[model samples]
Target: MQHLMLVPVLLPLLVAALMMLLGEERHRLKMALNVGSCAALLAVSCLLLLRASHDGAPQAVGVYLPGNWQAPFGIVLALDRLCALMLVLTSLVALAAALFACARWHRVGVHFHVLFQLQLMGLAGAFLTADLFNLFVFFEVTLAASYGLLLHGSGRARVLSGMHYIAINLAASALLLIGVSMLYGITGTLNMADLAQHIPTLRASDRGLLHAAAGILATAFLIKAAVWPLNFWLVPAYSAATAPVAALFALMTKLGVYSILRLWSLLFGDEAGASAQFGSLWLIGAGMLTMAFGAIGMMGSQRLGHLAGYAALLSSGTVLAVAGFGQNLLTAAMLYYLPASTLAISALFLLGDVMDRWRSPVDGADPYEPTSEAAPFLNARLEPTRGFNLDEEEQALVGRPIPAATAFVGLAFLLCTLMLSGLPPLPGFVGKFAMLNALFNPLGLAASAGAQPGLTGWVFVLVLIASGFLALTALVRAGIAHFWTAQGRGPLRVGLAEGVPIGALLLSCVLLTVAAGPALRYAQATADALHAPSGYVQSILGAEPVPSVAAGSTLDETAEATP
Candidate 1:
């Protein structure tokens, strides 16, 4: 029963390895395997979620110790409501991405299926690992896979932006190593649960060292999360990537947020003496600045991909700011917002790709292909293909009515816009409303009188409302400029495979809106579990009999223990 925890991680590893063994021409077979693996992953993730949240246990959390070794020594994988929710979300988006990529993206680059699966593996491992070292390992794995995916099409722009992406993350990785090593040296254990137990007992003299370690670690995560000053690389890097890859990359920033929530709640939540709520003010302040910057960027963006990039930053900032509040209700709301925003943004990335196709003038040549001798360098920016001509003669011609397919695409774009901007009648609005209600309700901190969030809460409220307005204004302008006022030389050619994924994603948003009650309740439960870590720690270090390992510890400990 406990072994089910390993499937999400191992299944992707197996699929990626098998795909690597196949020839490039075996595209159909590779896709078949990819789809099958994703289906299996979704199934297993659902089972894990159900098991973790089962009514009978109420306190149910699964901890799998690799090699039957005890905690603080061996690799451990812990499954709880939060982990399960993340797994299920990752698999769903992955399935959608796979289906969408089938149209042409999978073939655009070599080893797409392998890298995709590897990326999934890395995401799952990051969510499941119960220690700092493995967290760093999984972070590297995900980033390595993402580097390949970002450069999948290998155009000059892609390569250039990919180089910047690589250098930035490499620096982040070094910081992560330093932070993890510092913690391990102090705690005598890399296991997260053990670290939590040890943090409160550290001497006052060593507290400064711990803070330094945490600050370094958070700098790395903030970079990945695209928080303000450190987030300069995100827009170009994401905007330059191919559509499917960008869609998958939507969750990359969320991973950073997850790490923040997980570590902060576990290690610093009312447990660590002087370190409780450490750096939270910084989180809130930085998050607000990020949102402000994202809003301005969204308004000024020239391309749909860049607009989507700014939208992502806005979403990340909102969640980060709310998370900084440290209230259970705010955390619950953030959980709900996490999935809602992730799905909406991912759909936007996919939908943005199609919309770009519609607006762009047809060009026979690949815009992304490397052309210059210096294309391999880190700072090159290739010229993009020109779309519609705006010359007076071209504009003077009578415009054709929007085609039926084009109208449908526009409708899809509108829906995506509504969701991303938190417009009414969409899940985005609901998530934000829930968050605000949590912040300002009578039972809430600021509204209860004498709470610290008095001014801060209102600032958050104003920023949230203002960001949505900016999104609406920007999206409306883009929609009108592209779809209402202009027409391409020919009708946009959209196929069934291409349209299905977009429709499905939009439909899911609608369903999320309709079912907001149940969704919010589940998110609340997940947050409840997160804020109280005793149950999780007990599951990992206090309870249960160790399983028997079939073989002696002769192989690589982590690899052999994984299953």
Candidate 2:
């Protein structure tokens, strides 16, 4: 049982290494290993998720005492509900992306599986590690893997853009090191479980310094997340990368948001009220601006790649806004938006690739003069009379059609739109309903009470409504043209491998919609547990939060209860 936790982290690293041995020369071996590894990873993470939901406790795996040390001195890789759940989602998405990349496996070659496995290991390690230094180590591992993937199909654009991506993250690495070093210097500990208790005890001056370190650390996170002003690099980096690579980048933004939420739960609980008053306001404002910027960019865009890229930016805004808003809704939003946005963006990217491959001519003529009209796979070529040419009337009636594969890609974009726009019957709409429930009701306004938002909920309501309205308009305009209008171009047959992953994604969305009630209950449980993180400290370090009152002012007297 103790070692069950290691399965998610170890399996990918092992499989990736195994794949490296197989190499690209044996195509079947590479495919088998990739598919098997991901399947195993997904299965393990799901088991972990089940354990978390049932047990409702951090699963401990004291894997190695290395010199038989225990407590903070010994390393720990714990699986709690939040981390385990994230692992499940991460593995699922990574598996889908890996499977999708199979079509172009030959093009990607030897480096493909190596980088893919490393990326998953990094993500798993990040979620599991209890040590701060270990977090940095895993972060770099992830980055290194990502760098290779980014430049897998190298071109001038990827080369130049990948350089910027590396350089910026390197700078972030330095900052993270500094913050962790300062934190260790002050607390004399590197374990996250230990720091939670020690952080509130530092001298006022040290607290200020800690906050500064947090800010610097947040810079790295924000930069990665593509939050507003720092997001200048995201569009180019994401748009230029291959479809699967772009799909992985979709989750990177969430990493930053997750870290922030994790840190803030420790730093800014009701004990300080500091996290809420100052932190929430700042992020809420930034999120609003980011949503505006992304919306405007999407509205002005023409290319499918750029459109999807900007759409990623818009999803990042939702993360910030939800985090800033706080309460049960934050987790709920994360749950809904993550899968929704990933499917949406990924589907669109795959479609874009298809469009570029089979684009019809724009000169009012049929480029596919001889082609399989109804059954593409049945023939290599058709008679000149068999295919088609689009005249003016026909063109107008069908409207502009993307290439065969690209048309289906629109489903991903539609999913993304539903997520961003909070359309009905989708998980995003459920998330929106839950958020508004918390916002207006505040203090568990549902059949149950939620945390009191105080005045922040009011601010959140206004901001969300305003940005949401614009996003709605933008998406409606963007999608109506593609989905509602006729596709004048002839339909092309899609292969099973390509269609299956997307079908799975859509199927997942449907399940999420149908199961939203239970999901919300789970999120509420998650929120309740997170909001009171004493269990985390106790479970990991066998310690708990002990309040210390200021000499002159009693905490209760100074306190503003958020509930």
Candidate 3:
């Protein structure tokens, strides 16, 4: 049971390392290895999620202390319902991306499978780690893998975007290290459970330093979260990547939101004496502003990639703001919204890639060229003639006309737009309704707290409504331009490989809507666990009580003594 907690992190690391040693000529072997690994990961994640959710309270948290060292003394990996859920989501997306890439994108670069595995490893580690230091480490690992993947194809636009992405993240990384150091200096431990226990005991003066460190750390995380002002780099970087890469990148922003939600609730949520609700106002205010920014950006976006990027920002803002509310119902709704929205955006990205390719000219003619034309066209290569050849006289016949793949593209596009824009009959609308109901009903936050939502909360509501409206307007406009107003360049060929992943993603959203009751119940349980983190702390710390002396000791002295 304990060993399973480490599998998510170690399995990917081992696969990535093994892939690195394989030869470039072994493409088929590489593809098989990648698919097999992703399938195994998905299977393991599902089992872990089932165990975490079904097992009894204490048993639900599976904690592994490496080197047989105790908590706060060695690296600890903990898997609870929340971590298991994230692992499942990560593996699902990863598997989809891996399958989609195998269609053709894998040939664009060396080490594609290796880098992909490394990225998954990092994401899993980030979600499961019990210590702040390891979180930073995992962040670096993920970012490094992304940096390589961003420039995999090696084009001018990709290079330019990758440069900006790398530079900004490197700066954020520096801040992360500095903030972690400061927190360690003040609290004497890097374990999240330990930090939560120690924070309430800090002196007033030390609390000021702790707040400053937290502020720096939040800045780094918000940058990754794609929060306003700090998120200028996300649109360009994401918009320029290859389709499969962009789809995987959809989960990157969620990682930041996950970190903020987890750490904020554990360390500061009405628990840290002087620091209780320390940054709630900032979170709500910044999140609302980010939502507004994304809405505006979506309205102005001319490219499909940019529209998807802005949509991601909007999703992040919604989660961040709901998290700020500190209401269990809102958090539950946000949890449901997270995976639903991510899968939708990922499908959109994949669809965009196919659209881009379908519209592209092959040999200065329609990409879907006629197969039976009698003209022996010099550039007659198309989907049907991948490896075969024809004599000049025999190839001189006119190509056979085939129906365009427009139906699949248009239908998928409509579904994705509906999901992204929160239209009725989709999971997006259900999640939004759940959130709005929680916000306005008499039994909700306002009535229970004996207070109105105030100007800010109301503003959040207005922004939420307005963002959805803007998204709808933008998607409608884009849809009409691409599908209704435009003439078909040629008949597009949608391959089974490409169509399957998109369909799976859309189907998942439908399932989410169908199963909303049970899904939301699970989300509610997750929100409860987050808000009341005593169970989380106790799970990590085990039967022994937290050491009081550790709370007062200086981290520098502790560091010196440990070595």
Best by lDDT: 3
Q: For each candidate, how many residue pairs have backbone atoms clashing (under 3 Å)?
A: 1, 3, 15
Q: How displaced is residue 175 in candidate 1, in Å?
A: 0.4
Model 3 has an lDDT value of 0.86
The whole-model lDDT of each prediction reads 0.83, 0.69, 0.86
What TM-score should be assigned to candidate 2? 0.83
Error of 2 at 170 (Å): 1.1
- Residue 20 of model 2 has an lDDT of 74
lDDT of 3 by residue, 34-143 (tens): 88898899999999988888878633467787655678988888888788888988888888888889899988989999999999999999999999999999999999
Weakest 10 consecutive residues of candidate 2 by summed lDDT: 58-67
For model 3 the local lDDT of residue 255 reads 96
**Candidate 2: global Cα-lDDT?**
0.69
Ranking of predictions according to lDDT: 3, 1, 2
| Stretches > 4 Å off in candidate 1 | 55-59, 362-404, 446-451, 545-563
Candidate 3 — which residues are off by over 4 angstroms?
A: 58-60, 362-404, 446-452, 543-563
